[model samples]
Target: MTVFLIRRLMQAVVVLFVMSLIVFIGVYAIGNPIDILISPEADQIERERAIEALGLHLPMWEQYLVFLQRAVTGDLGRSFAFSTPALELIVERMPATLELAIAAMGISILVGIPLGMWAGFRPESLAGRAIMAGSILGFSLPTFWVGLMLIMVFAVHLGWLPSTGRGETVEFLGLQVSIFTLDGWSHLLLPAFNLALFKMALVIRLTRAGMRENLLMDYVKFARAKGLSTGRVIFVHVMKNIMIPVVTILGLELGSVIAFAVVTETIFAWPGMGKLIIDSINQLDRPVIVAYLLITVSMFIIINLVVDILYSVLDPRVRLKEMKS
Candidate 1:
């Protein structure tokens, strides 16, 4: 376990380095922020001063080295647009994004797994076919479009739920979240459902596939031969084996949910990191953009590490394989 963790940590460091280089270079090529930062009529000396102050006077490589130095000390520079530390700005909005992502994940897992298990257990049933069809539709629909339709139907016509924004948040454990309040949930349901649909469909498909495969394995047949109750056979014998893959996919997708929630946040006007990054990009705020992307890369790496560790714990074969290596 120690060796495995050490190897993963080393790999994560390399991945972060590569991602930082790519993000810094890519952001630099977007456009000169000096154009937006300084007045067009500013004198040459003033322009040069602004450039130096923003560290644009240095070569890109030197600037990257400076960034790396500061990053090693837990600094990713400040947002040019907001005049705040990049990490601080991202952290402020993180709870909103995190809560939304987690809510979406909850919906996906809670609803998708049961439906998928039932569909797999009774593939020939009418309800099973319907569930499969719904999953396909869930995958096919665009998130933004679905969000709009939901707003139009629920908010405009029925007036059942709020159309946009994170509503009525109460602070819990130093983070403001809406999950605890009824009014807050009314605001969350639409966007969370919109964000969850595709992932939910994915979970459904993954669970169904695993269920079908495990059901046909020799152990399943042996359990049946022991005259175990059908419910016990399916839930205990089949579900346990199927969970290994299901858990892996869900763990990785959790990172994606937080990282790529831009469209849903945009449509819903949610005050999350996704919206912040969009605005930063539009304003050519290199620090925030770079910081956000690098942080997102770090998140994926961390989640992958967690999933790998969970993989070993869930299946002893993985630990054995790693030890042999």
Candidate 2:
């Protein structure tokens, strides 16, 4: 297990390095920030100074090397638009994004697993059919549209929830969290539900598929032969086995939710990293854009590594295979 973990960590490092290079080069290629930073009426000397200050005057390779070195030392550079450290700005908004992601994942797991189990257990029932139909809509609808419809229904027409914003927050463990407060939770519900819709559908399908496959396996039949209660056999024996795949998907989806919540955040006006990234992109803030990409890529790598390690814990056969390899 230790050797396997080490191997995965090394692979993660390489992936992160390649991702950083791609992000750096791609962000630079988007456009010169100096064009936006410097005024239209600025003279040639001012333009030259601005370009030099941003290290744009240096050769691309040289600039990349400098960036790599600074990044290694945790210096991601200052945002041209915000006049602040890119990393600091991202960190400031990390809590909000994390809150939303966690809430969304919680909703997905809590709701999806049971619905999936029910559908798998009674696929032909009316309720199961209804759940499957809803899952289809969940997968087919666009996120933005879902978010808008949620707002129109819950916020505009019913007035049961706020349409936007991360409502009042109270500090907990040195971080401000909204869920602790009633008003804040009311604000969080709609967006988190909107963000979780697709993931919930995906989890339901995967879980249902896994449950169906496992229910017919010899071990499950043996457990039933042993006179174990149906509930215990299904919930304890089958659910545990089915969770391996579900957990893997949840881990990857969690990373994606954090990194790609831009549309949901924008539509809901949530003050999170996704909204910040959108603003940075609009302003062509190279440092912030590159930093966001690197952070997100690193998150994906880390989550994937964690999921791989979790596989060993959840299934001994996985660890045995890794050792044999």
**Deviating ranges (above 4 Å) for candidate 2:** 320-325
> Candidate 1: which pairs clash?
none
Cα displacement (angstroms), candidate 1, residue 250, comes to: 1.2
- Local error of candidate 2 at residue 224 (angstroms): 1.6
Q: After superposition, how far is residue 41 of candidate 2 from its true place, in Å?
A: 1.6
Candidate 1 lDDT by residue in tens digits, 241-320: 88899889999999999999999999999999999999999889999999999899989988887887787888777773
Stretches of candidate 1 off by over 4 Å are 320-325
- Model 1, C-alpha of 171: deviation from truth (Å): 2.0
Per-residue lDDT of candidate 2, residues 215-285 (tens digit): 99999999999999999999999999999999999999999999989999999999999999999998999
True lDDT of residue 280, candidate 2: 95
